[model samples]
Target chain A: MTPALAIRNVSHSYGARKALDDVSFSVPPGSFTMLLGLNGAGKSTLFSLVTRLYAARHGEIEIFGHNIMREPGAALRRLGVVFQARTLDLELSVMQNLLYHAALHGVGPIEARRLGQAALARAGLAERAKDKARALSGGQMRRVEIARALLHEPRLLLLDEPTVGLDIKARADLLALVRELVQEKRLGVLWATHLIDEIADDDQVVILHQGRVLATDRAQAIVVAQGAANIGEAFTRVTGVAQEKLSA
Target chain B: MSEIAAPAGFTFRQYLICLSGVVWREGLRFLHQRERFISALVRPLVWLFIFAAGFRQVLGVSIIPPYETYVLYEVYIAPGLMAMIQLFNGMQSSLSMVYDREMGNMRMLLVSPFPRWFLLGSKLLAGVAVSILQVYAFLLIAYFWEIEPPTKWGYLTVLPALALSGLMLGALGMLLSSLIKQLENFAGVMNFVIFPMFFASSALYPLWRVKESSPWLYYVCEVNPFTHAVELIRFAFYEKVAWTSLAIVFAYTSAFLVAAILAYDPARGMLMRRGG
Candidate 1:
């Protein structure tokens, strides 16, 4: 079967500085892949390329066998993206925001309202659907975003540093929610974050460093392969930086 | 049961829905921002009441297309002032685009399965929608203040002209927003594009007056696309069609729309600044 997402030989540059250099990766169906990288590690660049925000001139990106460059409409139809930035219109209610996105995706009113309300309920935000997005807490806002991303029933979901600025409980809750989606819905997920604790031992982890892939494998395999006792030490060994310093 | 999945390709119904959504969002935003509505009115009102009243003696007016005989300076500049409101409102939308691009609202719009041109057109349509309302508001005020009543048909006739000029100015704003990397630079757009375009044209003065003052400035005003926009509105207000002005406004709107679409192209590096 074709992978849910496939990125091959993708490279991008900003003037003389290369943001993503010959980067390649893939996320298989029904699997959770953590794109591990520090800030400026080209994680967002990779997301931008996959999302077709920035065209990649050097290589191709395929979403469920649809090439983003050659067939962006088809490729994008199956893909949903949640950017690192807060995107909800502050004045609009949660349902309004989701329905607006649905409209953009060409979902008619009845179906959009049904799907939007359902997604909100799944995210435990059903009661807050009528409230303005600005009235929600940061964690609730992120949940709204997650609900919005899922409203279209996209096969592949790309979330960039989604848990940022959330409390530990909120972050953990979001991670668990996403993990459940993978198990229950068989949704493919590419979760990008610099947090080490977010990656589970069984999850597929792709370590990116300096616009290049440093490693791609199971968490324990990477730990053992890199001659380290755990993911933290292995990450330090792979990137030649102290993990303590990264968290600090 | 079959799933209600998004179609594999784009569809016309989808495009119309998105365009309507864009327009709807603009209307909601406009309603929320009462201050913006007030400011949009205040700028034109100040020019109409104070500046035009003060300049009435200095700027002598001959019978113009819109006017049957001698008219007050305020009467002469009302259409131009209406266009000015659209111009400023157009730039305001551009400012919002820059803010939206930075804040990630633009990404949501761009990621849709629609063509980039359609998306940009949706944005222009939204801007035009908001701006035309603002223009009519200004026109209502002009009529109440007794700036010089246009023909009864003038109120209705000027709409298409307003829409054309609004789209032209709004398209120019979208083009600038795509090129401009920051919102702070928008002030420079005001100083450069808005002020120059308004002043260099027949907005506040007749082209003949400009010709008398400086032949060079007259040529500049004659060539300025905004002059044609103003002329279009001015003529239409009197139930006459300025064919040259109409054609010029149409052509400029198309050109600006194309340029804006090109600027918004991913290859151009306008939308994808690494940190911007």
Candidate 2:
């Protein structure tokens, strides 16, 4: 079977600086893939390309077997994205934001309401639907973004640091919800984050460093192959940077 | 149950819907900030009522082609006030763009499935609608001041002209917003654009009057797109069509729109810096 998301030799650059250099990868249908990288590792750049925010300078990206560059509209319709920045409209209610997004995608009112409610329920934000998005707590606002992303029931989901500013429980809750989404909805997920704890043992992991993919494998296998006690150590070995150095 | 195949491609309807959605969002934001609407009307209102009153005695009314016989000083400056509303509205729309960037809503707009041009165009259209509203309000207030146009049909002609001029100025604002890196610099730039573009054009005074001051400045005013815009509105208010002014406004609108799109292209590095 063709992978739900396929990226082939994608490269991008900012003036005088290479943000993503000849990167290639694929995620099988219904699989959860974790993109691990440090700051400036080009993970966000890759996400931007996949979401069609920035067109790649070289190589092709396919969404559900559709070429992203040549057939962007079709490819984009098959995927959903949750950006690192807070995209919710602060002045509007949660339901209003979802309805606005639905309208943008051409979803009718009835279907939008149904799908929006289901998504909010899944994200544990159903009761907060009528509340202004600005009035919600930071974690609640993040959940609203996740719910909004799922409103279209996309086959592929791209998340860029979804749990960046969440508390420990909020982060765990969000990750757990994402895992459930992958299983229940049969979604191919590309979860980009810099934290090793966010990657599970069975999850497919790709280690990116300096705009290049250093390694791609099962999280457990990578940890075992590096003779490391944890996924963090394996990440350090592959990326050639120690945890202390990175923190500093 | 049989499976339903997804469609092969997107349509212009999708683009239209996205554009409408963005415009609706801008309208809602404007509604939320009621003070902005009041301020938008009040600025032009003050100039029309107070400034025009003070200058009416000193400023001589000349026999311009668009005007029949001698026109009142307030009537003479009404189109300028309309143009002023559009200029300020255009800048106000971009202020929201910068605000959205800082508040993070602009990122949402950029990540949509639709092309960036449609998104930016929708924003310009919304600004046009707001500018039209302010123009009509000014017209009603001018009526109270006994400077009403000869016929109500004159409004129909003025609408399209205001739209074209609003679009041109709004496109310029979008281009500036993309080029300006910091919000602090916006005030300085606005002072530069707003005053020069307004005073240099035929907004407050006639081009012939400008000629008496400096012939070179009159040449610059003649070439300024704002002059054509003001001329378009001035002629329309008299129930006359100024084809030359329309052509110039349309030409400038097309150029500004194209430049705005190129400035916003994701590959052009402007958006990349913001996205990055």
* C-alpha RMSD over true interface residues, model 2: 3.1
Candidate 1 residue spans exceeding 4 A from truth = B1-6, B272-275
Model 1 lDDT per residue over A1-248, tens place = 79999989988888789888888888998999999988999998888888878887888899888898888888887878889999999988888899889888887767989999889989998899899999999989988998898888888989999999999999999999999989988889999999998989999999999999989999989998998988988999999977975563
For model 2, chain A alone compared with the true chain A gives a TM-score of 0.96
- Residues B1-276, candidate 2: write the lDDT tens digits: 000266764577766666777777777877888888888788877888899889989999899879988987888888988998898888877777776766556666665656668777887897888778878987887788887667888878788888889999889888877777667867876688888888899988898888998999999898898888899989988888789989998998899889888877766646776554
- Please give the C-alpha DockQ score of model 1: 0.63
DockQ of candidate 2 (2 decimals): 0.47
lDDT of 1 by residue, B110-168 (tens): 88777788888998999998999998888888878886445588888888999999999
Root mean square deviation (Cα) for candidate 1: 1.6
TM per candidate, chain B:
0.95, 0.93
Off by over 4 Å in 2: A244-248, B1-4, B11-16, B267-269, B273-276
- Models 1 onward score TM values of 0.97, 0.94
Q: Candidate 2 on A108-177: residue-level lDDT in tens?
A: 5677889899889888888998999989988888888888877766788889988888888988888998
Q: Top model by DockQ, which number?
A: 1
